[model samples]
Structures are given as C-alpha cells and as structure tokens.
Target: MESPHAVLLVVLIATFAICNLVQAEDQEGFISLDCGLPPNEVSPYIEPITGLRFSSDSSFIQSGIIGKVDKSFETLKSYMTLRYFPDGKRNCYNLIVKQGTTYMIRATALYGNYDGHNNSPKFDLYIGANFWTTLDTGKSITGVGEEITYIPRSNSLDVCLVKTDTTTPFLSLLELRPLDKDTYLTTSGSLKNFRRYYLSNSESIIAYPEDVKDRIWESRFESEWKQISTTLKPNNSIGGYFVPQNALMTAAIPANESAPFSLTEELDSPTDELYVYLHFSEVQSLKANESREFDMLWGGEVVYDAFSPEYLNITTIQTNTPVTCKDGKCNLELRRTKNSTLPPLLNAIEFYTVIKFPQLETNETDVVAIKDIKATYELNRITWQGDPCVPQKFRWVGLDCNSLDTLTLPRITSLNLSSTGLKGNIAAGIQNLTHLEKLDLSNNNLTGGIPEFLANMKSLSFINLSKNNLNGSIPQALLKREKDGLKLSVDEKTRCFPGSCVTTTKKKFPVMIVALVSSAVVVIVVVLVLIFVFKKKKPSNLEALPPSSNTPCENVTSTSISDTSIETKRKRFSYSEVLEMTKNLQRPLGEGGFGVVYHGDINGSSQQVAVKLLSQSSTQGYKEFKAEVNSSSNFC
Candidate 1:
C-alpha cells in the first residue's frame, strides 16, 4: 500500500496538471491585453496566478504614449507599464468580438506615479458611445478595475477612455471574456459589476484555474461570523454562472449559530437599481435529525420564502427583476425557517448595478464603409478613434450624420475630404455610404475616373471632384444624374462624354501644336517690330516715353491678374468673431495635420460652419493654407 503522504502529493500533482490543461483549452474567445507593453517585449504569456494569456495593446489602439510604473509596484507584469492618453479628449481600444456575443469586459488602471507627479488621476470610461463609469485612481499604488457584462450590437466594440479633468487618462490592462448568451440577461442595457466576494477566512484572492472564467473573487470574512469549510469539493454544475467549487466549499454563518445571517449595503443614490446573486452549498455534514432551511429577505421584503442548500451541491439565487433601495439602503437577510435546526449560511455573493444604454450605435454598413475608407487612405486623424456617430458631440470630423430619428440608427450623410491630402484612386468604400448626400474630394491627388457605383447611389446629390489629374470619359449614368439635378463639379478640360473622349484628346493635341506655332510666329513678329522701331526711333524719343509705357506687356498683364485676384479674395473673419462663431471653440469636429476643426454656427444665422483653426506649430507654409481655404470656399 502507498504511504498517505505520497498519495496526497500524487493527487495534488495530477490536479495541478489537469487545471493547466483545462485552462489551455478554455481560453478560445478570451482577449487579455497588457496595456503599454512595448511591441518588442515578451508577450502572449500565461499569467501564473490567473492562467490567462496577455499580449501587448499596440495593435488595438493608435494613440497614447507608453510609460513604466514606479519600480516599487513592478511585481506583476501587467501592472508594470501603462498607456496614457494626453492629446485627444478621447482615446479608444477597438476590440473585435463576435456579434451579439455576451462578454465580461474589464478595464484596470494603476497610477504608480508613472509621470513622477504624485497626483492621482480621475477620468471617465465609456463603452461604445455611452458612459460606463468614472474611475478614480486614488492615492494608493494599488490598482482599480471596472467590469461590465455587455452584449455588443456589432462585431466591434470600442472601449474609450475620456479625459474628464485636467489629469490624463491611462490604462494598465483590458480584458474580454466571452460569456454564454443566455447568462446575466438584463431587461435592458448592460450590468456593471459592483462587488464579487467569496466568504472565506483566508486573505488570498481566487481567480482563474479555480473559477474557470477568470473572475476575481476577493475573500471576505467578518469577525462576527464563523467560517465553516469542507475538504470535499462541491458539485458546481448548476447554470452557466460557473461558481467555482473552491468558493462554494467555504461558508459564513453568524458567530451565534442561532442568529440570522444578514448583510447591508448603502446605495450611492436612491434611484440606483441593483442585481444580487447569492451562491450557497452545504459544506458541513449534518446529523440524521438536523436540517437547514431559510427565507431570504431584501429590504424587509421576503424574496424567497423557503430555500435549502443541497448537500455538496451548488444553489444560486438571483433577483429576477432589478431592485431599488428607495431609502438608500439595502438589507439582505437569510433567516432560518421554523423547521430548520441549523444556522443560515452564505458561500459567495455578487452585486451589479443596472446601467441603461439608451444611445444606439451608428448604422453598421456606414461604420464599415467609413472604417474601410480610413484604412484605405491610412487616415491618422486624432479624433477618429471612436464611433463615427452617436453621442452627437464627438462625431468624427468631416462627417455629417443624420440622427434626427431617435429610433433609427445614425447614418453618414456628408463627408468632406476637401484639401485633406488624399492620394491614390478614389476609395470604393465610399459607395457603401448608402445615405451619403454630399461628397467633397476636391484638391486631392486622387487620379481615378469616377466609379459607376457613385451614379447608383440615389441619395448622393452633390459631388465635387475638381482640381485632380483625372483623364476619363464621364459615365452616362452620371451624366444622366447630373442632368436630373445632381450638383456635379469636375475639371472639364480633362474629361469628356463617352464617344467624344478619344476624339477630344486627339483634337486637343493638334490644337495645342497650332497654338504653340502661332505663339512662336507672334514672338518673331514682335521681335522684328521692336528692331524696326529701335532702328527708326532715336534714343531721345524712347527716353521721352512714360516709364509705365516702357514696361513689358507681360508685367502689365501679371499686375492686372494680381489685382483681380485681390479683388476676388474671400472675406476674412477676426479672432474675436471666430470665437463668437465657434462659442470659444467648444465643439471640436476633428484634428488633422493642419490643425483642429471646430463645428460652429454662423452668428445670427442657422447655417452651420466648420472653422479650421491653424495650429501655431504647423510646418505647412502659406500656400497650403491658402489652398485649404480656397477649397473650403469653393465647396461652400
């Protein structure tokens, strides 16, 4: 027979190996990002404590600077570094997830005085376009984390960090764990985690390898409570909640075995709604005549009239409807029933606050189209980090969305890429904007003929393709649309009708040669005339002429053209007038290489305007600025 100690060691080793195999197979849809970890650093490593794989966040976001935390808190690799956003008002991580799949999204932040400034920062966190919560990294090096159970409307989810105060917004870790679709269902909106704890006498935290879902359950024990635990593992094959057996193995009962087990929580506000989940198991063996029965109460109201924990089996109790503590306090008590001979006990508890997401995301097709366009052109606009529409104030620059109907998803109505330094052929993705009304591609280096898809877009009423090096025949469909009231603008010299394109180019070649020959003959005649005049007229006669008359004709013509240009120059607004128009530059539209654009209204009128404020540090010269202004004026 094997020794007892040796048998115990063999069992432990087998269990450890099994847990490792389970974790390796279960992480299919898990996404764990270690923010600010450099691309060249080691990544995709399994964290020993949680058994979850973590990778650098460089691929998920485009903005923010990386910094290492203070050396004192460098024990955990995930907490050693962070990503801090100091430029844009909002920076986001674009996470790709299965559409309609429920997920537990978690974001962690730690301020270990990374900037050498001891000040802790407070900022707002957002899920897609809706506000999730405000995170305050208080004066401790200990980190803070927020988790939410959500189902994204589309395949992509945006986790945004918004700068709400003077302090910068930073993130240490971001994780996504896919949950069963039927689990954690809410009537409407997402659920934000408030507290998740396992009743225990130990100080160690329990997560993955024990929980299977990688949920962090902190130990909680009150001096007034008596802890009861069993070495036997509880059967946790209940619902999809996945309450770990280790958590259910321990139970908390009142120190006085006959007293009711109770817990009280104070609500942040009277209107705050909450969902509570209670997990229980009979960890202690009972005598033949002993029985344990209880009635669960919330705020003095009985929720469950009679409840009993099956021996060594998981029993989960959750609120069917959201509960509100009107008086600002919630009291949960499990009172022993009249027939019960044992005390009421609890194994674990979880609390979540109901968070309503009323704002709808942008139309999926338009979002896909715009993001494709951004990729096609490699647009690096600072303000293009989140959703293209919804949350009206933060819409992407150069995009006008139609969100008049609250029930309908927002659609991109106008896109202004005028003088934005776009290159290559016109993007085909623009055709996906089904509701697009106006498009401005003027003053770009786009070199392709207009795509036929544009003619098929019935909603497109205006198109400006001027000042490009395009040489092609206009499609008949487009010409028809133009005749039927489409406002089309193109460089007429470079384009022609279907049959006339080749003939037109052929005619232009000879016409250009004839014009050059005529110019040469004119120059010869002028030279001969000047020589004859010089020979016939005396030097004194030439000197008698006015200085202005002696000037070359080319100089006079150039002067006349310059005067005409000055006369036709657009009106310029003063700094104070711009401020008044833009209401002190409060509504930002977007930022580009030139500067930031502000969405404003013309003073005393309902007309909307976009004011491009030049950055003081821009390296572009006056010529580019003038071209941008000219493009805008022509579009208007």
Candidate 2:
C-alpha cells in the first residue's frame, strides 16, 4: 500500500489532470469503484456484469445478464462446479452484499442440458425479504443464459437457486454480469399480462402492468445514483402513475461515472422529482506511456474529462451529454413528466410511466327507442346523457339486463324508473318489450290511463298501477296473477260485466287443453266432410295445376270458396275471451327466484300458471332500490 503522503500526492495529480482535460466539459466531480486487481475472473458458475452499486436506506435492486468472456481476463481454472447437478441444471450461489443500498442483481448462467428430460430451474436472489427476484430456469444451449432481474424493496433480501427438473445437469454457468442495472423497460413494451418482468443488467427487461394504481422503477447501476426520473405520455387507457422514492432516500450519487441515463421530470401540476444514486465502472485501457485525459459523454455532449481516463459524477450532466472517456464509472438521475401531449415512447432515450386509470360511464338506457310496446301509462322523462355506457359506472341504479346471454335484443323483464328526480308521463314505448315481466312506476307524478298495449305482452306476470292518476278500468287480463298483497279498494277484476268476478288468491290450473284438443279434433272432422263433398264433383285429373306452383291450392274462386267457409275457420279466441277464462281459481305453485308463480286456468288451457307480483316495495323505499328488484341474477 502507498503511504498516506504518497496517496495524497497521487490524488492531487489525478485531480489536476482531470480538471485540465475537462476545461470544455461541465465541471463536476467524477468517481469510480473497481473489482480487486483481476482483468477478467470468469464466474463460470455465477452471474455476469457488475451493476450500479450505490448504497441507500430504501434498497431497490434489479439484476442483469452475464457478458461474453474475455480470454486474457478469464479465470477458468478458478471456476469449479460450485453446485454441479447434471440432471436438472440446478445451481445456487450465496451472494454476500451490504444492506440499505439499492442494487440491481442479475445472474447469467449457460445452460448445458440438451436431453428431452432437460427442464429450466427456478432461481431467486434475495437480500432478506426486502430484496429478491425469481427466474424460471430455462433450456438454452446457445450459451446465453436466461436474463432475469429483481429489485428487492425490503432489507432482508437474499438469492436462492431452483432446479425444476431433477434429471438434467443441475445448473451451468458460462457468461456473467453483462449489464449494469437490475430493472426493465420494454422499448417495444412488456410481456403482456405479466404483473412485473425485469431484465438483468443494462437491457430494459422488466415490464409491469399499469392495472395497479402505484408503480415502482428500480435503478440500473450497481452503484447508487444522485437522481432518477420516469416519464409517461398521456393516455386515458394507459393508466394512472407513481414512482417509489425521492433522492433524500439514500447516498447522493453512484460510484461509476462512465455514462448515465436521462428521464423527463417536470409537471405543470404539483409532482415530485427523482434523486438516484447510481454506480458503474469507468475503465481506461492505457499504455504505460499514454497519459492523456479523456472526455465523458452521456447522450452526446461531454459532461467531464478524466486525466487518468476513468469515471466521473455525471449525475448533473444535461440531457444528451456525452459519456466519452474510457475506463471510468457513471451514475445519473433524470426526472419524469406527467400527462404530456407528446407521442408515447417506451425508449425515447428516457421515459417511463405506470398508470392506474379508472373506467367511466355505465348506464345509458333510452326509452324513446322502444315505441311500439306502449304501457297503460304516460311515458316521461328519463335523464339524458351522451357518454358511452360501461358496467360499474354511469349511475344506472335499477336497470338490470338478462344475464343468460348479455347480447341479443336485451330482455327487459323488469324496470324501476321511479323518483329519479324526473318528471313526465310513463313512456308508452316501454310495451315494445314483449319480454317485460315486471313494471314499477309508482310514487311519481304520472297521469293518464295505463296503455292497453301492455296486455299484449304474454310475459307480464306482475303490475303496479298504484298511487298514480290512473282512471281507466283495470285490464282483467293483468289481474289474472295476484302479486304482493294489493289494496282491494280498486276494482281490478272483470268490469265488462260490472264486477262479474272477484279474483281470489286461490290458484287455478288451466283446463284449456280439453277445448284445444276438442277443437283440433272437431276441425279435422269438419275439414274431412267438406273435402269429401267438394271432391265428389271434381274430375280425377284435378290434381294438376301448374308445374312451378309452390302451394297446391285449388283453382276454385269465390263461388267454390263459399260452399265450406264455416268449416275452414277454426274456433278463434279473442283477447277479451282469454281474460274471461281466468274467472276460475286454483292453488299456489310457490315462488321462484323472480316472484310467486301460480297455477291458473285460462278458459280450457291446463297447467298454464304464471309468475306474478303486484308492486315493488323498494322503489317507494329507495330511489335506486328499483334496479336491484330487477335482478338479472334470476335469469342471467
């Protein structure tokens, strides 16, 4: 070791030489850390490339790959099969490192297994639980080991080796530490669906999904940096963003000063800046007589020059600055920009942004769209909106759609459009939905008789015509099914005969099958008689009409049609007739997921019961209670 006096003199000479050489460059302190005097000591059994080795309190480490081996600097004899296992290619290393320093830990090992039985091992580098990354061992006989990086956010992180296959050689080591940092930035973007992916060393190998609200980026160098930056372009779908720590978290700068990275760091809004502490090696291959200083550039322009040709503090180097000098180290910090209008680029020299974006607009049902299916009520005001509808947004409280099939003409079986602070007559267009089984428009300022078209919907099992200015006679067909206990104050049963029938809670199963069967049998007999009478007078060759005629219609006109007109007409039941048949009663079939279904007799039809409900309690209960009542869960 040189004496203190001698070392002081050497430092002064180096500093003076550095100052004179960097006259045209940015004047800043430069430094570097070195591996003990060995040109190339191959860790044939371990990771490649050294990284930013700066120390910090909140340690965040990423890893890198092993670089190509140099013949002269190679220490192959020293490379022993530290943990040789030929079957599964499984190997482990116990890396001893200091704590409270942010590190990017990357390991690159050559794969030697080629048999079909060869499988990748699972390996992890840990510094307690706070720092660790797991890599899936792979089969790569090409000698380029699978590159994976990890950034441990905690303090007790450590590294662990995994061997997935117990058959092939455990794990082989070839190249080591090819990169300098332990984070990922996909220039073309990340592996889709992966929550987090990192690359060992310099290559941006990590890609984290923006699905989460907060995101973290780790430093790339083995040495700490003075500042760091992450930039993101604006995108509603890109996601909201965040960074882990500020510069106050650790040491001011990295040990390496060879070169550095840049990041966007300004926001019109109140945003924080990143302060990184990076570390890298600044090597200078010089001849014994060569003593010239060299200038260092990051992106382009020179930051500082080194007389001894080594690393410098390039942290303050402006964007595009040159990291020109050889045999020197570098570590720098860049800032991130939020919500910029610029085009999005993952590797635009320097840019990174992780977002947590939210979804907007959920409810947008229109009433004017359905005009044919009129209800026995006035159609009125539903709030208007221009935004597109999404599921969890847009304040659509009580509009539930059929679940079985979400697409197709939506089955609007239920609706609770009450007290939306809305004003108007119930929309007549609602009856256009023939599938509507329930309707609740109570406690609103609606006037006029309920639309008659509502009765046309064969699926309507429940009705709520209460607390409105409705004056027309209640449609007896709507009363066929009793729902919630209703007020007997209104005469909802047969008004054509002036209270001709009092509807009862007792259920009734239809016997209409007898009439249908009898009618079919009668029609068959009548048709046979009429055909025989007409055929008696026809010629035997009457079957020939036209060659291309689709239907076998008789050529007989008005004169021949009148002979059997009565028999041709089947017994047709009018709308009023079906209503009269429900005068009889039966028993309850019990309630289902939707409502109470009953076994009722409509004229002679049997086993034709209905799902019935009178009124929803929640509408008058809560403004949004109506949507829940229309639970698509029953069918969807």
Candidate 3:
C-alpha cells in the first residue's frame, strides 16, 4: 500500500491536470454573439469590441429592415432591430458552431414599439428549421426572450425568424455560449429549456465584463420592490452547481421584514409545467446567534420550511413544480421564518418549461441526388452549400422542399433551373428526386434525346424544356402524360419525328443564292417603275404648306408623341396637363431598388396610372426602359 503523503500528492496532481484540461476546452469551444447591436449598418463576420464574431441579418434575408429601438428607455437604448418579413417563410442567421457540442442559445426580442405602431408582435422562433419557441411580447414594452440548450448535429446552426399571418417576425438580440461537458445532461438526448433572472435591486443591466458569459441579467424594477444592499459581499461563484459566475455579485433583500416577498408571472396559457430554481448566498456573516432563515412557498404549497442562510458558500434549491396558470398567473413567494430576525433575501431565480424539440434531418436519398446533380452541371449561379433540404430556411437555392409537420425529413418538391446557362444532357441523378412535382430546364444548350425516365416520376405536373437544341422525338409516355394534365413546353422547331429520329433538312447554298439574285432583280424593277411614275406626276406648281398655322384644330396642341406605332391612336399631353394629372408627382406608392413608383389618378376616366420616376444616375434604367418598350410593341 502507498503512504498517505504519496497518495495525497498523486490526487492533487490529478485534480490540477483535470482543471487545466477543462480550461483549455472552454477557451476553444466558447462563442458569443451580440445581434443587432450597432445601428445603421450591415456587417458580415464582424468582430466587435467584445471579441465575439457576429453577422447582421441583411446578408441572409433579402427583404426586411434594420433599425435601432426607441431610446426612451435607458437600459435598451443601445440595441437594434431586424423586422418586417412579409413572406411567411423563415429568414435565417447561420452561425458557425462545433459539431456535437452543447451550447446555450438565447434570443431577445424587444419590440419597444420600434415601428411606432404601438403594437407588439408575436412570432415563432426556430433552430435550423425546427420549431423552438413562440416569442409573444404580450403587453410589456421592456423585453421578452427565450433560452435553450442544444447540441448541434452539423457544423452550422441556422437560427431563423419565422413570420406569421397577423404580424411580421423580428429579432433584437442573439447570444450563443458553449457550456462545459456533462453540465446539462438529458437521458433522452433532448434539449433543455432554461430561464435566467439577474435578481438585483440596483439599476445595473449586467453583461459582458461584469457577467463574462455575456448573459443578459435584467435588473429589477425598484417600484415593485424596496431595495436592500449588503455591505459585506460574498464570493462570486457558487459551489458544485451550474450557477452563473457573476449571478451573486449583487443581491436583493425585501423591505418589510414581516411580509413575504412574492413574484407572479403571466403565462400565455394555463397548461405550462415548469421546473424552478432559486439561488441564495449570505452577504454578511452572522455575529454569535444572529441568524436569517426563510421558507419557500410555490403556489400556496410549502417547499422548504427551514432554509438556513450560509455565508461565502452558495446554496441552490430545485423543485419540480407543475403549475397551471390560473387566471394566467403563477406565483412564488419567499417568507422569513417565524423565529428569524432578518428578512428573506434572493440572489437569482429561473423557470424552465418542458418541451420536445423537433429532430430535423434531411432525407438521405434526396441529399445524394441533389449533390450529384450540382456536381454534374457545375451549377454555380447560387451557392449550393450544406444540406439540401433539412433546414427549410437555408434550402439549396432555386429549389423548393415539401413542408412536413410531423415528419422531419424533407422532400424535394420543385427544381427551377430556367436560364441557369446549363449545357449538358439531363442528368440521370434527377431520377432520385421521386417527389419532384415541377422541373424547368428551359433556355439552355441541352442537346440530347429527352430522357424517358421523367415519365416514371409520378408527381411531375409541369416541365419546361423550351429554347433548347434537343432533336429527339417526344417520348410517348411524356406526350400521354401531357394529355392527362401535365403541362409541357417543348420547342417545335427542334423536335424530330418518332421511330426514325428524322431531323429537318436545310436547303443547299447554290439554291439559296439563285433565289436571292432573282428576288433582288424583281425589287430593282419595282423601284424603277415607281420612280418613273413619281417624275410624271411631280407637283411643280404645288405650294408648300405655311410654316406657321394659327388655325385651331379642336383647340388641342400636340406636345408629346407616344412611342407606340404610327398607325395606332396617339394622345398627346402638355407638360402642365401631365403635372395636373400627377398632382405634381407626389405621394409615392412604393420604392424599388432602382426607382420610386407613384400612384396617380387620370381625369375623365376611372383608371389609376402608376408613374415610375427613374433615378437620373441609373445607368441600367435606360437600357431596361428601351427593352421594355420594344417588347411591348412587339407583343401588341
């Protein structure tokens, strides 16, 4: 047997090694993000003063807005906002994370009536296309947030803002903090829900250097509770428990020593079951027999009857409390013991509701097929990175996936490759997308017999292969399917006859030259004859019309000419008349990326006209306008 001194030395060395290893891992895996912090800018991969890299939502979402919150409140004046997603789909913020590591992710939504509409918005939050929670800023203009602990299966995590019908979804803040291994364990491999409150009577919103983890510790409202501060502060960390490092730096004691301090929260529904945690630490040491004791009551039930206070050491009590929000309220109270001299005090409190997270994984077969197709055509128009269909918010560009509620695996429903400049045979990998409903391969250089395997795709309802150089007869299966409601568009000029693949033949050059010469001789003879007739009927005595015409023609002055055909009826309007009809070009309907579009009402008709004023500096605007005019004339 080893000596006691040797054993003690060995144990000490082992403990020191373990601590060093843990510290190294924490530094390597920890990540933090402060979303929408600096205003009036779009940043991608910007490292702020906090040393954590974050990106704005502008790069991921195309349409929406970003701005600062109302500055009337001092605590939240520095925060920013991202809102107004009219499309009901999800807009995601992709964060790079280590695979198979547990992370605590939190999102804060502070409406503060940012739009000045004085209305709060409610919407669902998502994690990599899976439903996480619903953020409802019910009545409080302060802030509302949700926190969850999850282990990401992939290297990237997609946090999405999902819009609802009644209101647009938005996000104000987001933070991701990696946790120590074996900290929050789940037997069933599911996510844990947590709510953290920074209980302080002082008006300090603690974060960053104060909290270190960058967790938002909301300060208590002084009006709701009277303040009590301890002169002798306790150690910052709690023992053996996962309490925040700086949570106990400040503490609060109730004002009235005789009455219990209580807190009540309003839940969205009455069916919420929660797990509660209360953290406590003694600020001042008791002299001799001076003691402070308390009993905790949750919803009229006594949970802890004789809870004694401890100094320097931290104590945490946990309970599984199933609470139904009667009148949408759940109450908790902390009362002093009958024999105690001091009032009850609390450092922090948390409530976590139990929920099952969705298991989002892409279908394996669809993944293989889509990846192969991407490789075959070298389709680089859109970035084809990551999984093809797992996260609905970050699906492969130019593709649509089926929305499955109960089922997590997604199916490819549509493939739009129109005008993608793809030049090759229709890839056989497409056969693997069994659920494909529509396929567009128009306006490409694809030259080959139409693949017959397409007819086997039962759900295909639409196919476009026009403006291609394909020269094979249409497969009978496709033709038959077209008759049964599958809309098909194939160019007639390149289509060949069935059974022999007989292509249209071109005329010889000699025959074309002979026909061109004869046409030119006939055109010369007609021109000579017209000239001779014009000379014989020359009006030598005819006088030209007067340069100035005072005679009025229906009191209408032609000021502008329409760009339409000469034979078409043209109506002219003077500059003043145009201004009168447009109301001096005021009241714009909407503004696009290039110009502002105005709404105008014309006189003598019930029609409303839209006038778009192109920006003078727009170089491409003139080209687009001319092309549009030519196309319209040809169509008419």
Candidate 4:
C-alpha cells in the first residue's frame, strides 16, 4: 500500500518533470517566412493561424518576378507575394538555426495561375547540398508543399529551389519549427519524415503549444463509432511525448459487443516500406471487471494482437514491422479483438517513409560567388539555377566552368561579356573569380584605364579590351605580361596616346573660329532675305497675327490668309452673320455659356463656318460676341 505522503511526493515529482519538458519544448524557435510578403510588414499569426513570426524576402535580392495567389485559399493568400524565378535559376533562402538541433521545414508553392498562362512548374528542392524532394506541381492550382525533418550540422540551413526546363520556379511559404530531440527516433542516423493525420469526431484543427512541435494533425471521423468527447484540455506537456492533447483528447468506440469498430486508412505510398503509429486513450473510466481489447492489423497481418488499453491515459502502439506497399498503396486497420467487451477506438495516427537522398552538390562558396556575380550585373536572361557545373550541359550564360562531377567544386575559367551592353568601369567584383583564364570586355562602354589587378590574375592567358572607352597608358605589369605570351587586344580607340591621353585643342581653335564666322554670316543673309520676302507678300488690311512660335500649325494667322490674292479673300461677316449663317440656330454643334455653336454653311457661298449664338442673359457671352466681331474685321 502506498502512503499518502509518498503519493503526494510522486505527484510533485511528475509535475516538476512535466514543467521542465514544457519549458524545453517552448524554448524552441519558430520562424515563418511569407516568401513574397510585403517588405517590412509585421503580421503575426493568430486563431486559425499558428502564432508564428511572419517575415518577407527583403534580405534577399529583390526578384523582379512576383505574383498574388487566389483569395479562396485564405491560408496562403496572406502569403501570396511569391518570388518567382522566371530565369529558371536556383534561388535559396538561408535560415539561421540552432546547431545540432532537429527541425521540421516546410515549403509551399502555388501557381495561382499568377502568370495567367496556367503553366505549372516542376523543380527540385535542396537542403544545403542534399536533395530534399522534387516539387512537381502537375496541373493543380491548390499549391504544392513538401515537409522534411533535418538536423543542421551548421548554424544555418539553405532551402533552395532548382529550376527545370519544364517551368519557372517559385516559392510561396517557408516555415521552420524546432522539434524536441526525442520526437522521432531513428537508427540510420537519418531522421524519418512523418505525416500526421488527426482522427476525431469533431471539427477542429489541433496545433502549437498543444502539440509543442506545432504539427498540423488533420481531423477525421467515422459514422459507425460512438463519439466520446473529453473535457480534458491539453497542457504544454503530454507525459514524455510532445504530441498535441487534441490528438489524444477525442475517441470513437462501438456501442455494443456484437459490433466491431475498425479504422482503415489507405496510405498513398507504393513500393516503399512504411512506419505507422496509432494513438489510443480510454476516454471512459471502466468498471473493475470491465476490459477492452483490440488487434491492429497491417494489411491482414496482426501486428498487435489482443491488446488491452488502460483507462483515461494514452497508449500508443506503433508497427515495428514495415508494411510493404503494393502498387503505391498500403492499408492499415484497427479492429476489436474476439471476446473483448468494448469496441476499438483511436485518437490519431502518424505515418512515415524512409527516403534515400542523392549525393550532395559542389562546394557552396563557388556557387554563391557565381550567384552574386549574376545578381550584381543583372544577368538574368540565362537560367542559372542549381549546380552551375554539375551535369555539364547547363552552366550559366557566357561562363566556362571546370568540374569533375556533382562531388567536385567547379571553377569559373572564362568570362565573355563582349557586346553584352556592360557599361561603366568593369565590375571590380570580377576579382572574386580567381580561376579565370580569359576575359573579354570588348565593344562596351567600359571606361577608366585598365586596372593593374588584371596583371595579377596569373591564370589569364587572353584578354580583349577593344572598342571600349578606356584611356591612360596600359599598366606596366600588364605590358610585362603581354611580353610574356599573355594575349592582349586593345584597339586604338580604347588605348591612350603617349602624352596626355587628351587631344590638344590648339589646332582645332582656328578652324572652329572660321566655322562660327561662316555660320553667323549665313544666318544674317537668310534672315534679311526672309524679311524682304515677307514685307512684299503682306496684305495692307492685315491686323493681328498669331505668334509663330506659341501658336499651333492649325491656328492660321490673318497675315497668312491676306497673303493670298484679293480675289481669293472671301467676304467676312460680323455679329449679325451669326443669326443668318446658322439658319436660325437649327444646326447644333456644341454647347457653351454663349448658347450653342452651330455648324453652318455660308448664306451665299459653299463655305462652311461655326457660328455661336450668344446668350442674351450672359454678360460674358455679349463681350465674347463683340470680340468675335472685332476679330472678323481684321481679315483682308
């Protein structure tokens, strides 16, 4: 018999243990990146959303390609600002994480028909250099997501998206949540990626401090079983497991002994071995003689036979035996054992498959350098994603790389920027590419004399600086290199002269003076001839002339009209002509304060004119009519 004091001490010790466990799990960090989120936005998740810190891609190079997703997917619409890689280049998101800690990373991509072309892309996902998963978003717009459990050897992890030929790559969401060390134990020193499905008779999503790891446990229910609801709420800790309380809070059991309760799930994994866990909790407190037993079967094979569950406490039974999947499908079931008094019940289930990753890619330093170079010069026309030199066929535009395989780091051997419209001084950052053998900056607007650093580049065997605007004497080191078999090309246009590099202006000064004098004399004679011709062509009745510079070509002046012969000058009428010309204002043109302007034919001629009927009530209209009459008197 246990003493009251000993029982109290045991409860206190258990309480302390649970507290410590909760604290450790809570200390884990959660980073959620909304990929294309608006820069500097600080929206925190709440309620239906997880309490995650949301961030944007402001730290990364601003990709010109961005798009919004449909509002129907509210969970993702908030993260619609997607950074798309139209150039089909590999883009990576570097996250600083705790070293030697396990983390669950999830990335989601949604086409949203964002480009309006409805072209879904296929790409490879990478963690550090290791291949993580393939992102093949077939034809669905629902968005594709891949989750992986990884332990970062370093303080950071690089989540990369590799573009393929089929479509452009893009990212919508990136979530990283640190997990408890003992959550998913494995023997191969490799972590197994688990997919959790929540089974319940209720409508609710369970996550976060309840799950501690914040895993999304999808809910499910059956019509045959009686739903047992528990008032027990999930606290921060659940014994030694970090699974959510909601996962183990609800259960469904059969009503009678004659009927058997079973849960069968078809896991969509063909040809691969699987690991499954069934979470159970006896929701009802049974009588002293009452016993509930069940048998769990993996494709008709009894893995756990005649297992009895304890009351009000969780008992998780996992399949130690790998279920061989046929045709990419494996079925698992939990049924009541024979002679058992109670029906079978389940709270949640977790499934996982082991994946064999391919060999990691080349060294990261060289890869990052090339990416920076492309970014610096805005060279986006070429799809430069993934390993630059691995696989050989696709190695960025105008760059020659030397590498043995995916295991070997590639070196940039040659660069061809000739006729690439590269302007200004040659980017000094090219110094980072120390392995270069040939450099061509020809036919560009590159200025500022040849950099002496080029001579220090011992690997360079050939260099072309032709047709550029470079000036000043070539560096002595470069000249020495030129003498020592270094192929150099600098045309006369780019090479500097012996003395100043600047042309002398003394010889051109006299020629310039003579040209100016000739120009001034020509201008004076032309102006006098124009004035004489204009005076002879002018008509005596000409009054006001429109300013030639300020007026449009359509605003013909009185002098230009009068310059015609007297016979060509038609008779002009005054204010009274408005009433006669418009035929009693029958033909409407447009409205104004001065009544309406009407399109009218001249009373005695075929000529047409626009006449305005001045409103009698408007003083401004009367003044405008008088001005129109005075203007008509000026015509020849």
Best by lDDT: 1
- Listed in order, each prediction's TM-score against the native is 0.76, 0.21, 0.52, 0.54
**Window of ten residues with lowest summed lDDT in model 2:** 27-36
Query: What would the per-residue lDDT of candidate 3 be over residues 131-229, giving only the tens digit for each residue?
Result: 787777653456666777788876767777766657767776677887665544454333435445757755344444344444545455434455544
Residue 257 CA error for candidate 1 (Å)?
3.0
Please tell me which model should have the higher TM-score, number 2 or number 4.
4
Per-residue C-alpha lDDT of model 1 across residues 515-573, encoded as one tens digit per residue: 75774465345334433543465111011011122222211122221122212223334
List the candidates ranked by TM-score, beginning with the highest: 1, 4, 3, 2
Error of 3 at 344 (Å): 4.3
Candidate 4 colliding pairs: 36-81, 89-385, 90-385, 198-218, 270-328
lDDT of 3: 0.60
**Best TM-score among the predictions, by candidate number:** 1
lDDT of every predicted structure (CA atoms):
0.78, 0.29, 0.60, 0.61
Q: Is candidate 1 or candidate 2 better by lDDT?
A: 1
lDDT of 2 by residue, 503-561 (tens): 32211213466655664455345335433543674321111111122332332333221
lDDT per residue as tens, model 4, 196-215:
66667554555554566756
Per-model tally of clashing residue pairs: 0, 168, 0, 5
Candidate 2 to truth, TM: 0.21
